[model samples]
Target: MLVDLFDFALPPERIALRPAAPRDTARMLVVTPDALADRIVRDLPSQLRRGDLLVFNDTRVIPAQLEGTRGDARIGATLHKREGPRRWRAFVRNARRLRDGDLIDFGAGVAAAARDRADDGSWALEFAGDEPVELLLERAGRMPLPPYIAGKRATDARDADDYQTMFANEPGAVAAPTAALHFTPDLLAALAAAGVDHATLTLHVGAGTFLPVKADDTADHRMHAEWGRIDAATAERLNTVRAAGGRVIAVGTTSLRLIESAAGDDGVIRPFEGDTAIFITPGYRFRGIDGLMTNFHLPRSTLFMLVSALMGLERMQAAYAHAITRDYRFYSYGDASLLLP
Candidate 1:
């Protein structure tokens, strides 16, 4: 299929700059194969049955954005995937200007020094501190806000809370599993009371999650790799749920991708601890995940393509059209949708 098929017009006004007050009070759009229901996230439990299992991605967003200059070229960079504690793969604004052997310095008081660029146009930066590089990123790095938002102005401290999931734990991700952003502890407790079971898997979301589908033919597209892990215990729990005929409801595309990547054709899941570049698109049969809970994504992005795989491309396009018409918010801190294939 052509990537352009997923294109649609989303009003700039619908792109939310901030999160909703009290979090879980945000809107939810539930779509079954036959019907579509508009509801609030607080009413999520009311939509679930007794035996479904909810799997969430618990990887937290780190302070991945860095502001510095390459000689006279001012650039904004987002540290995406970590190659090591000190080395990482990053996306910068003026990627061409920052050549190999060039040093881009962040302002004073920060303990860091930039290194030469890799052949791929990414920097190989190292830090100067007694603490670990991860620890330093927590202290000196800024929120890795998306380009759409950063274009408006600089990212502030407010994004410390806004650009993360409520269940954020293992920090390495440059981006949040946004569907989990609407969840609050109270709402999760409410789901538990309603007999919904929760499971967690870790998929460190990379800056690649923000990459657009540049290929004209979708089959030609290459997926970006990101670190993901499903421990033996979590896999066993999910497999047990499946044996009991329970639905596997993935909370985000990250979880859905990781679960499907780790499961066998028979739908049995096993422990997985490594990087995966599983690109999901339409026509792929789901080995796991009966339904998905995710935020609205970019028009021609890979995320939208994954949603197309679960729900039909035509159907998903209709849904996006509906969302646009209804003034539904789009992207990271936006409202969510529950899709049943």
Candidate 2:
């Protein structure tokens, strides 16, 4: 399908620069197969049945943005994937100034050598020293905020906590699973009391999620791979939920994609580990998840395409139109939507 088909006009003011005061206070637009309702995140537990399970992505956001100097040229990089304990694949801003084997010096004694460059213009960088790359990043890196929000204002200390979800534990992701940011301890207790069971998986969301679709057609777009894991126990538990005739509700697109990647043609989810570059588009049949809770996405973005595939293209367009008119927020720090089709 033409990528232009997913395009929609969004007013700049509708983009949220900051999250709601109480995370659960964010607005949630529920789009069922036959109806649309306006609600808040705190109202989620009541939106579904007792036996339904909500799958959350437990991957934590890492400080992936870095600034350095290479041969007197200022360079910026956002680490998107881990190649090894000390090696990473990153998208560089001053990439033309870098070459294979060239060393770039990030301030505070941190440095890395560019090992290789991909056809897509990303660089393979291997950090210097053996103090654990995570430690090096802690000293030289900054939060990798989505460009939509960062472009409008500078990222600050508040974003350090706001960009992460309550379920964050395993560290690797460069980007936050925005939809899960609406969750809080109070909300979790309420959901449990409401009889909504929850589970967790890991998908290290990469900076690729913020990349724009340059392809004219959906078939030409190639999704960048992200690491994810689902243990045998979790898979069995999810299968059990399905067997008991309960719905599996994915908390974010990250969780939805990972679960779908682990599901078989027979719709049974199995233990999975490693990378997934699953690109969901219209006409794709979903097998693992019954519903999704995600943030409002960018125009012509892959996320919008995925939601369009979940619901219908026309229905999502209408849903978005309603959201816009009602003054709901948009993007990573924005409001959310509950999509059930």
Candidate 3:
């Protein structure tokens, strides 16, 4: 498949900068091979059968976008990945000018130094503190919102809470697991009342997920690696659900990728933890999930490609056109879709 085959046009107004006032009120596009239906997110349980399991990624979004001054250099950085408590992989501006042994002060007596290089043109910055890196970032950094949103001048006040999912717990991801964001505590209780069971997994979303396929051909586009894990207990629970003939519905691409990467047709999820660079495109048979709950994506993105794989390319392209015509929201903090394959 060629990367350009997934292309489509979207109006700028269709991008949603903020979520709906009531989270569950967001629209849901229901895509089955034979029919394309639409409904509100609150109607999820009715849309899904009773014997379906929704798998969600509980990785919390960190305030990983940080700013500091390297002696008037005025640097900006995002803690892209963790190396050690004292070390981190960060993307910095004016990177070519920066060399080993450059000190950047955060203006609060704490600082970091550019130590080395990681792949993808990222830098290794070592921080000064006994506190864990997560805690340090929590106090120092700002919410790493995507570049498209521009109303907010500073990422301080509302973003700290709004950018995270209601069920956020495991602290690692720089980006939110968007599908989980639509579910409120009240909505979960309602879904449970309607006989749906929820299981949690962790896949620390990395910078790679947002990268466009630079290669002309899909086969040549290198997949970006992100760290993920599924525990023994969660694996057992999933197996039990499968044995009972229930369907597994992944809540986001992150969860879907990790679940599919960890389990095969044997139908047992083993305890697996590590980096996964799995590139899923059309004609790739899905090994784990039967349903997917996800947000609408950018044109020609890896996410769009993943959607093309789930609901055939023809169906997906039509769906995107339909979404545009009906003025559905696009990208993170946008509307969602429930896919049954």
Candidate 4:
């Protein structure tokens, strides 16, 4: 399909610079097959059925954004995928100034050598130290905020908390699962009271998620790989939920994609742990998930295409139009949308 089919205009002022004060107070747009409803994030329990299960991505957002210098040239790096214990694949800003063996020094005694460049222009960076990369990152890196948000304002200390979800435990993701950001302890209690169960999987969301689809056609686009894991216990539980006639609703696209990657054509989910570069577009058959909860996406983005695959392209276009007119927030720190097709 033509990428332009998913294009839409969004007002710059509609972007949210900060989250709702209480988190769960954020607005939600519920999009069903035939209707759209406006509600708040705290009202999720009432919106979902008693037998439904919400799958969350427990991947924690790390402070992966780094600014360093190789000689006189300034280099910026956002570590996306973990290649090894001391190696990571990162997208660099001043990549043109880097050579195969050039070492860039990030202040605070952190430094890494640039390795092989990929077809996407990202390079493998092997840190130079015996210290755990996480510790090194903690000393030298800042939160990897989306370019849309970071372009408007600087990343601050508040983002260390605001960008993470209550379920964050496994630290690796460069990007946060924004849909789960609307969830809180109180909200989870309410959901439990309503008999709605939740489960978790790990999908270390990469900076590639924020990359725009530059290809004119969806067929020409290539999705960057991200690491994810689903244990046998979690897979079994998800299957049990569906077997009991409950709906499996993914809390974010990250969870949904990982679930789909683990599922066979028979629609049974299996334990999986590896890199996934699944690109979901319209006409793809969904096997594992019944619904999705996600934030409003950018124009012509793969995320919008994924949502369009779940709902129809025209339907999502109308839903987005309504969201825009209703003053709903947009992007990684934006309002939520519950899509059921």
How many clashing pairs per prediction, in order?
Answer: 0, 0, 0, 0
Candidate 3 structure, TM-score to reference: 0.95
Q: Report clash pairs, candidate 2.
A: none
Question: Which tens-of-lDDT digit does each residue in 1-341 have in candidate 2?
Answer: 99999999999999999999899999999998799999999999899889899999999999999999998999999999999999999999989988899999989889999988998999989999989999999999999999988898998999999999999999999999989999999999999998899999999999999899999999999999999999999999999999999999999999999999999999999999999999999999999999999999999999999999999999999999999999999999999999989
For 152-213, candidate 3 gives per-residue lDDT tens digits of 34465777777888778988888889988899988888888887889999998876666667
Q: Per-residue lDDT of 138-212 in model 4, one digit per residue for the tens?
A: 999999999999999999989999999999999999999999999999999999999999999999999999988
Give the better candidate number (1 or 4) by lDDT. 4
Model-by-model lDDT, in order?
0.84, 0.96, 0.84, 0.96
- What candidate 1 gets wrong by more than 4 Å, as runs, is 70-72, 109-120, 128-130
Candidate 1 lDDT by residue in tens digits, 1-341: 88888888898999988878789988888877777788889999999878889999999988888777767878767888888777777877777676555666665434344566655566656665566777667656788888777777678878888888878999899988989999999999999999998999999998888877778988998887999999999999998887888889999999999999998898788899999999888888898778999999998899999998999988888888888888888888788999987
Model 2 residue 230 distance off true place after TM-score fit, in angstroms: 0.4
Per-prediction TM-score, please? Answer: 0.94, 0.99, 0.95, 0.99
Candidate 3 residue 133 Cα shift, in angstroms, is: 2.0
Clashing pairs in 3: none
